[model samples]
Target: MVETGNRYMDNVSKLISWGHWFSFINILFALVIATRYLVAADWPPSLLGQGYMLVSWLGHFSFLGFAFYLLLIFPISFLVPNEKAMRLIAVFIATVGTTTLLLDTQSFTLFNFHLNPLVWNYLFGGEGPQATNLLFIAIPFIFLLQLTASGLIWRNLKTLHQKKLGPVIATSLFVAFLLTHTIHIWADASYYRPITMQKANFPLSYPMTAKTFLIRHGWMQQNEQEKSNRHTHPGREIKYPLRAIEVNQPQPKMNVLLVMIDALRADMLNPTNMPALSQFAGSASTFNHHFSGSNHARLGIFTTFYGLPSQYWPDISDAYTPPILMTQLQQAGYQFGLFSGQGFLQPEHMQTSFNSIEQLNMAEPISPVYDGDTQAVKQWQQWLNQQNNNGAPWFSYLYLNTPTGMEVPPEFDGPHQPTSTMLQAQQAGPESLIKGLFNDYQNAVLFTDQQLNRVFTTLAQLSALENTIVIVTSAHGQEFDDTGNNNWGHQSNYAWAQTQVPLVIHWPGKTPIQVDKDTSHLDIVPTLMQGLFETTTASRYYTSGLNLFGPLKRDFILLGDEENYVVYQADRITEFTPKGNAYVLDRNYHELENAEPDIQVLMKVLNELRRFYPNN
Candidate 1:
């Protein structure tokens, strides 16, 4: 019996030793995996930026990983108090953690941003059968991968129980993580050197509030805090609530028609290219210095609807942020007809913008469908003609994406023959090719004007123009390498070429006039609300926009994109970037290298922006 007992003890010792070896192997394996994440691009714009990115990547990820190990995984391994049981728990945790990390890597590759609520909402929220089928197909492969990771983790944990080196290595990793993470956050806050901000959406990142702290201490400008706040959601307490709208006078029941031509630059509305629109603008109220709420379509549309900036999208989306605008219109019995060139009411949550919206199922044909601005417009015309004259006021939204896609009928494609097509022109680096691209964009505008003429003629034929308030604008403007750094897209920059768009309002009883005061897309909904309801001018202050007929709110206006926020006042424009970079430019979009900033104007603009977000 004694000899048998000794033999059993000897076997147990061998098993424990084997477990230790396996644990060491997994530690090495995990290190290799971590190293893959630590690797970065060699071509950072600056040496400081390169170092900041590297340290931030290593420190933030490593620290986060070590924290999980110590707080969650390690406790589970030792708390069980049974060698075999502890090993089982440890293996399970390690497998899950490893799988999550792998999945994150794959997600980062697929989308520039990290895995977040937005991605999940897009993937599984409404994709229906496709998302389900994809999950079904992936389950088997994921299960096999998990099993393989579990086997490795089991061996690793068994071996780790026999050694003290595990704790020592973990301590070393934790220390390194702390050092790098501190440097990353501090640099971002103090120097505005966007170290970790390049990956601001990295999984589980703590929001950076150090900039606010710095501002309070008088160590840094409040500009950083303002820009940061633009990305945050508003609180539960609504800033702009439903106030009783006091009307100035009695008004007739009128129909409102909004026609948005995508990427129509303010300078491009000419007698030559867009003759029809030019002729209409000549007799309408045109804002010569109008700017888009944002440089991109999604945010621009969000601003137009909410009468606020894009930062409010998340919170506002959760519950109707400013439900009063649309609800009031609906209550007043305004029939709505919403049309879009591309898919509208998407991201699902934005459906709140309209009360019972109807969409047209029209595809963009390869060839021009008879000089039409968009298939949606043609469908809308047909739908409009069929509606019974029920004497109810109506609101119709017509969106045309012509200059955006730069597509036109072959009949209208003459006068701007380029050396290459749009796709090739984008890659062709010559100045002439860039000019050719701009020419194509202009030709597209002309084609859209022709299509608008059809809509105008139809309205005239139906006598709808007599009582209709026609408002023409755009979601945002486009770029054609106008900035000289190969910036050929709308969302790429916040320069005048990308933010400036024309706004033309043709009120039935109002006379034609050109307004040079700076205006924005935010003013559209408020203007419509006031005009439709005959609200007093003072009520416009409730919105972020000023009444076109009232005094200007301030000298400057705030505009933004996903990556940039800008303040434009007078001829000088100030752009604030996520990486803490700020620059001033003249009206011509030329960088004013040594020009002194208008601090007063900048602060006023920033203060207005801070009102939208509570935290800043």
Candidate 2:
């Protein structure tokens, strides 16, 4: 009787052990699938995800300290393979992870997943069952898997302990996964790399969002008072909208919203390269004679923001300039917000004017550079809704950095590559490859344009479309296959590719005025004023840039490395690429041969930049 009773107890223990072991195995397997789907959705790219990594990294280091403490307690290289022990670890992980999911709901700013459910408020936010239902099913299944795995571990404890170190190895792996976020906080790297890169919005939004949140919650009260005060003609204190101030007219404020597509060039504005984008642009004012400011992103940013002339601030860093566009809008009773793809706090280019700047960084801390910007946009809209009662018009800037910032050329994953694909078409030669690269650029451009369609759609849905003025322009065109110096992107000038770009303006409820002459980003700030205020045209009154609504002073646009110190300009008929200090001064950029007058103007702009940026 004693022997039979012991046998029954032993069998019961084995079954319980198997149940826990299988449960764990199932959970671990489920983890792999969760990671896979997250990757497939390209989740990080749309989240504007960044800061999660820095926090995660800090968590990893903490775990490491805990692991060493555990080593001291056990002294045996492994924990005893008791099913109870494995079950304890499994329960620990699932409990912490699920609790995190529940606690994720807070102020919208804190809702990174946007799955916050305000069960208490009828009008609070949450849509469809996407993230919520996913977690709902995932958590239970994960628990079941963990339970089974724990049971399996129990049945073979004694012999398995003699041979294998699976528990230690598994724990170590979990620790390693924890540490990856540290790298994310500091730099850009993905664990499942080459798979997708856009990291979280650490450097991009940490301080910016914190600051904006405080300000949004009335911390800006001190600054808000400054906004209400205006200086007089002699810098005397005056009330805003002074009664004695001269008035041309009281015009309806057209809430202008500008979307600057960074690193975008013109040639890609088409059907084959960018079909969806092409369709979007077809409805707006398209200008054939648009050129970018300076070479690329940094330089282009300064010119468009301040209209200080690319001659003054080249990279928007380490140099000082006068008041800029965003500030001017604030002076005129407008609220300015920016949503960008570049790290908002680094590289110095983005540190300039704005009331608030959203994430505009990455999807996760360890994700790629061009990934998270779009999520910043979604957050921007949510924020707008919350602040709708602020009683002032708003100017929001959404700058996308995709297709343009990919480390490699664009990729098309539908129906495979068509017969005319760049790969097949450019097999001819290096020049052909260059052409293919150009083709790639255009395809990315199209991708960018298609995304804008979403932006417009969202704006219209919110009743914010007609009350806004939208301007679309690129920072600079890119040089491919070293047509200039074997370089493959936006930092230099080559022909018809780098300096020349496209520009468009679509004012809500206003007529689209097309121009035949030429315009560059320098004209942006002033032209923006043109759209809002009916008085002083951008170029004629306060700014040096020629107004699109006024006379055209430039026929051929200027191009330079720093400032076109050594000048180059092509006439309407010339066709030759210039060496050394180069410029395209001819008509349609056919090429120019030693044109003197145009070259002189180029030299003047160069000298002007030097005068302003003397210390730089």
Candidate 3:
């Protein structure tokens, strides 16, 4: 019996020894991860010059990694006495941790963001099949690597007696790290500024709760004041499903057709490529210096419908806030129809806003882009024909994804082709093949123009043009390395090349007025309400825009995506980036090194943001 007891003790001793060694290896792995994060941050020289800031970030990451490993892996490894069970548990934990790291790396490469709930949904919820497939392919490799490491840990076993010293030391250090990190967060939050630099140091370090606490306690100034104002006002809960607006006059009984083309740059409107749209612009109210509410389709379309900035999207979408414009039109007895070439839910989760849409033409080109556009337009025409004699005011929304793919029929293909060298340079380096890419995009635009001609011709044939109000625009503009910064797509930046778009409104019996002043997508819903319904009541419910018929009331326009915001004024532009850096630029987008941030303008914008999204 004594010998049996001795044998059991020997086995446990071996297991504990293996556990400690493996735990130490995890600490080393944590160090490697911290190093990788620093490299990925790519901090600017200005930021690096802040000696205390640099030291704080480094110390924070190092302590975070050490604490996490000691608190988690060390406890598990040391406590499990059975050798086989310990190995299994350790391998499982390692696999999960490694997988998370891989996903974070991929997300940063693609979107300059870490993995979050929204991005996770996009990955697993049937969007970007090619990218998802590639991720799955790489998973097996990650698992194999994890398994090899686990094997090494198992093989390098040693005999060791049970001890409490290591656990006590590790636990104390973990507590100290936690206290230090919390204090750092509290100190940063009290300053009334975003903790952007801390966020960049490690993923998911936003200090959200700490900031809220500071604001609530009056420790912060700028944002705290704005937040206090929101709750103090009577009936400040933003009314949605907007109070059924009472039109003072009988609404104009006209067929409304809104065509939103994708990625059609303002400069692409030319006689050769977009002849139809250019000609249409002549007899329509053209907003020549118009900008989108955002540089991406999700926010752009939301802004047009909601008449608000993209920052309000989460509130309206998550709560299923039916667009006031749509609800008002519905109350006025208008039937709605929607046709989209791309699946409305992909890339942006727009289905959250337009919840009642049942049928969608979510087909893409199997060969040529024109073929797909042709089919979508024909389907729209058929749908329009069915509504011809209903005698009810009708609203149709057509979203074309033709130019989004930058493909065209052979006959419409332009003369430029990217050379092999140019393609290689673009893929490997920062050089852009702009000429070739623009040619392809423009050819696609030409094909889209032909499709537009077909729609108008069909409307004329059906006698719908006599009373229909046709409004034409694009969701956002495309980029072609315009800044020589290798930005070749929309939604990647808030530059003018990506945000500026064309807006042409055609109301029956209305004079064509070309307005060259700056305008924005926020002006759309209010303009339609005033022009078509002659109703101004919806403006009372926190609408961020004024009717286009009035003089420009705002001296500046706001633009943004998920990660950054920009304020564009007459002579200059101010950009607020995710890493807490502010950039000032000239009208032409050239950086002004000596320009100071316009704090008043920034504060005004931030106040509006807090007013709209108090809880975010």
All candidates: TM-score: 0.60, 0.50, 0.61
lDDT for predicted candidate 3 compared with the true structure: 0.66
> lDDT of all predictions, in order shown?
0.63, 0.48, 0.66
lDDT string for model 1 (477-529, tens) is 88887777678768877877888898888888887788888998777767776
**Where is model 3 more than 4 Å wrong at Cα?**
1-246, 249-252, 347-350, 358-368, 411-433, 538-542, 578-580, 613-616
The model with the greatest TM-score is 3
Better of 2 and 3 by TM-score: 3
Which ranges in model 1 have alpha carbons more than 4 Å from their true place?
A: 1-238, 242-252, 318-324, 348-352, 355-373, 411-413, 422-429, 578-580, 612-616
The digit string of per-residue lDDT tens for model 3 on 395-431 reads: 8987787788888765654544663244766674333
Error of 3 at 342 (Å): 1.9
TM-score of candidate 2 relative to the true fold: 0.50
Worst 10 residues of 3 by lDDT: 229-238
Tell me the lDDT of model 2 at 212.
46
Candidate 2 per-residue C-alpha lDDT over 301-385 given as tens digits, one digit per residue, 9 for 90 to 100: 6667765554334223322223345545555666666666554643324344331233334332213433545565666677667
- Candidates 1 and 2: which is better by TM-score? 1
Range of the 10 consecutive residues with the lowest summed lDDT in candidate 1: 229-238
For all candidates, the clash counts are 5, 52, 0
